[model samples]
Target chain A: MIENVCLGQYIPGSSILHRLDPRIKILSFVIFMIISFMSGNIFSMSILILSVAVIILLSGVPLKVYFQSTKYILFLIFLSCVFNVFYDYGEAVFKFWVLTVTLESIKNSVIIILRVTSLMFVSSSVMFTTSHSNISFAIETFMKPLSIFKINAQDIATMITISLKFVPIIFEETNKIINAQRSRGADLDNKNIIKKVKSYIPIIFPLFFLSFKRASDLAVAMESRCYNNIIKRTSIREFKISILDISCLIYIIVILIGVVYCEYLMI
Target chain B: MSALDIKNLSYIYNQGTDLEKIAVNNVNLSINDGEIIGIIGHTGSGKSTFAQMLSGTVKPTAGKIFLYGKDIWKDYKNRKEVYFKVGLVFQYPEKQLFAQTVYEDIAFGPKNQGFSEGETEEKVFEALDFVNIDKKLLNRSPFELSGGEKRRVAIAGIFAMNPGVLILDEPTSGLDPISREKIINNILSYHSKKRGAVIFISHFMEETARISDRVAIMDRGKIKMVDTPENVFYDYKSLKSINLDAPQITKIVSNIHSKGYNINKKIVTVEKGTQEILRLLRE
Candidate 1:
């Protein structure tokens, strides 16, 4: 429901981090996430968390505004922690009426929460600062290395970007349908689970129809613009790996290596 | 007493959120049985929000809506019953049709209201006939019909319920002239035959002036004027203030009146305008 509310949600800022090439930010983001997973103990998790915090600070976006994005997923994060705390079988540190909290369990819970939070915050920073069009271009460029594996990177990137684009469009269409149905006395909010599922038919029916129609229109528009599907489609300007981009990439690589070595020590 | 009465109704969107907006301010209106009212307002003037409140699609943020002198939100049971009594056809509702065949789609509302199999079929066919769609097209997939035909079928879906108050939002929008005439004529005919109250929102002033018993001018979430079509049109000053104008012929007739000639300022149609001008010129 929240996602259906508006478009052009990116917050604008003039920080140097906002000016960094989206391609480097994307690569560094992925590298950091992977390093977060590799991080085992509290110390290593702190390092990963610190990296995400630094990126968030550099983005110059209001910290509270950036964290508000995680509110929707807080339920899932809590569920994970609660499940881990109870189900993890280890040396008990505290016991209460047939329930036991163990040292290993608490540590595992903290690691997972920190890992997920770090991933969410870092990726959000990228989305907050980078425009969607630039992200699409960066994704297309980064996938070029996948050509060695005999994959069409452009096709993959285009598909990803198109799917991402449709998410918001579909959300908007669904909200309109919901409002329309409600105006007709279709009470969706005060219904049981089974009834709720049935109520979705009206909203879903129109949305499916509109999405196909939109896809067809988009295809025709793309063709009219002389879109060539094959043979290394040209860009008006090519991306050059600048000094800032290289330094950011190097720093991300060093962090990944350091985290892996720390995990080795923990084991 | 009015068949439907809204007293001091107000609504706010995203009420508790930082982005909260007052879509419909405190306003009161009423509709009696067998009255056809046209509500006209520009986009975001809260006309649509008002329509939603009337049909019980939304509970007002404040105030009470009465149907037959009883509060609509008195209880959950009464609220459910009120929906069938006040049918709402959204703009381009045709796209909401999803049944495999046209008949089932048209019968959706009546069936949802718990009509028996034979009765539902009878009502669905009656609605289709009322909307003037060809009987031959009843068995076809709704998706296969032309846009205007699909729109009619969608309307027939709501008509099958045979509600006491029918509300339509921009029913003739995006249709050819002939199709527009057909839909508007169908609505007028339905109103005459059923004798039910009808509230419709439209931007086409000429068409609305022709069919509506009364016109309600809304500006910035407030109903500026509610009068018979002639009276509403005659008030050109207020209409101009709201960036709306009377029908083209009405404006010409009013201009003639301004030139110290004897003419009815209430004249709306082009034919009446011509006759009145000729009569004045003869003198």
Candidate 2:
């Protein structure tokens, strides 16, 4: 059974990672992603993976949550390995009928798997720790430079965060639609792929229609609240970067330098 | 045989997690054929989950639902068959409407049951008339109908299936008094004519009192009380303990009964209260 892991929802903790300024966390995630892409050697990537594991442990979430977050990307990782396994140019250490296993292909598969894991881990750590309000604040602050190009950064942040907030609601609405259709004798458990896809039509239409209605209702509510584009926005709570955030940033810079050195100057 | 025999029904949400909560627990209830049972509870009291389980939309964690002495989930085929045996009209049923026209929307259930095209059309028209919707509006888009009309059409869709048991969750919610009356009357008429059980769930005490033959009060995951409307309302202290209310009219008559009149405190609807008050005046 495919687990519906609660990966994207905030876990609500007051650990050091959760208390960091939203801007600092966002900046660190960006730098971490770049480091992940640059660290190709086994030693550097191993260090990167260990650092991400430590971050996950420090986020006050259990190890199961880290694995649960990885479950969603497991299929993609498997697919990438399957495709890369056949591209063998190195010495074939083992041979079977139309199947070849080479040391280089094996290494490539390991690196691909590691990259995917690192990508998910670094982001999931931050995502599980940060609240929706903080995320929007971080994105808005990070995109301030885009305002000079005639873009409404705040509105962009609002739209993104609103969509994120509606993700769970959409899942709940879809489940309700599925059950409603099933009660009407709409059989969705057929083994035939075509039949199963066709069975989803009755559910899809109602869900789409309901989402549009909800959107209009939300718009009306926002209008009633006097939300306008022209007004200068104000936040109820402001975040400040503390000493912990500075130390965390310094640690990230050290790892970033190690990754660049390993990629370029390693003997 | 009972229309439904639910034994030791329990449902836990997010089980085994920190967020685990008992949505419904060890609930036992039996429904006779054609009996209208109104389930009343405060929000989060598990009425909806209980109703959903009855319709087989939700699976009970530790219970069995028997329809007419047959376990509905005995096998996959029987479970699929039972899906049609207990029709569920979810809350805000109007939002489930998606067909191009009212005729198509009302025909969806019967058509899914593999009724012949002619039979499906017949049942659809019959259900329309059952709900007091005019056949002239059959071809109109469901989006074009008024809110009350859409609601009726949604219920009529389920009515067309002609299930042995019908469960409607909050059928008259968010409507004007007259529309609410019409919808309730429509459901009552359908229930009376078919002689099928109807499980009505609502937070509105008066609406439940007006329609249901028996009212079941739910509190925190269990059925706190189940009796006739008169008997249930008589236990006002227990009802208040669960943060529920008797019908407004019943409360008024009961208040008068407490103050000094020979008023019948079991009165639920306004019309009944008025008649009782007039009798006291004439005396």
Candidate 3:
């Protein structure tokens, strides 16, 4: 059940999105998110969704994976839509005791669902195309100017990369621990809330201990190899911008302008 | 009825995804009560997945698993009961220990089985005796114990439940020779006292050969053969074909037999090999 989550997980491929500059991908993801929020009418929203779909196809990652990443957030989106349907004040399409379904509310709910879903797909598409190390490196490059404010970009990047690497490892460890506990007759499926929480104690303690041991061992391994923060790090894979990246950026800017214009016309 | 019966059992991981893999495939086997079955296979030959399926930890993607002629997954509510009946001791089980003390850890299983306080304690002590753990160490934290001791405590945790069939997956790997022997002995003693079926999975051919009543060879997610040690070891060619080797003694005996020696080629244990070679020399 835990393995189904594909959010922030990179799928290795050689597609155009995979080969694009990580900086440009991150920048485009942010811009896409802004455009999705600004997209209000059906025309702009459909345009945003269509472009995201195209980018997802270009990413060479399966559409199922992106859907899986967004599946967990579907409940949140549904809740917000339900709230908008009941709470919004406008023309009543249907009336009931203490409740009314308004045409405006229906429009708001549709826009909310489309906006949130498009945002989720865009983010998951970006993550599926970019590896964790590349993402961290891009962040480091973006934060390099912060060094003037007494910040260490490389250290922050190393931390992010290590944490991202640990996510999968820790997930595997948790699964092992859960299986082990289950084998020992731990009733993890108890319906009683208190009992269920208590069952996790066995799993949590071992996971915490294992994570600490791993972190300390990793630190020792790095130190043994003469790792020092005082020295600047050099990466083997250097980021270089290409014409494809520039074209992709320009395409995103055009989309941003179109979305803003549509929102202005709607207002 | 057999203690455990698996028919056309198969498990596919990540089904419908590109990462899909057939971990266990259309496997069939039956283990009798009071039997010791050794399963040997390569690293990715689906041995662990097969073991998990038998112990009811993993649900089979296809086919059925029967515990004493009853389908285990027939009713979801009874799954926990099945788990208690078929205990699994995973590789490096010591990592599973999380109780405040060794006693508490061993008692966890029996307590889960809903035994009373007195019965839980008795079962815990019995498990300790079976695994040869000292009573004095029961009060000590499981984390404070040495590697071998921690392993024994973890095994004892399973034994306290007194499962009808104990399935151990590579239980002795990464341990010293002495520790390995001790664990094997503990398992043997537990089987003798409980008279329960045992499914032992291991890379060490000699240990499996020494303990198993019938050996099952697995390859590519299928059971290639299930036969006695004598027959399985005698046919070394088939075992090697699946990237598995017979016990060292069996190999040496076969080598000696190939050199025109009149000794039996099916010797699987050191003691039996020595006796056969001594008999050949005297003749």
Q: What would the per-residue lDDT of candidate 1 be over residues B34-145, giving only the tens digit for each residue?
A: 9999998777888878888888877899989998887888854655588888888887788678777899788777876778999999998889878998889888999999
Chain A TM-scores for all candidates read 0.86, 0.94, 0.93
Q: Judged by lDDT against the true structure, how good is candidate 2?
A: 0.87
Model 3 chain A: weakest 10-residue lDDT segment is: A1-10
**Given candidate 3, what's the lDDT at residue A91?**
88
Q: Tell me model 1's lDDT, rounded to 2 decimals.
A: 0.81
Query: What TM-score describes the B chain of model 2?
Result: 0.96
Task: Provide the lowest-lDDT 10-residue window in model 3 chain B.
Answer: B75-84
- lDDT tens per residue, model 1, A84-114: 8876487989888878889888888877887
Give the root-mean-square deviation of each candidate in angstroms: 3.9, 2.2, 2.1
* TM-score of the first chain of model 3: 0.93
Give the DockQ (2 decimals) of all models: 0.35, 0.55, 0.57
TM-score of 3: 0.95
- Quick one: ranking by lDDT, best first? 3, 2, 1
Poorly placed runs, candidate 2 (over 4 Å): A1-7, B75-78
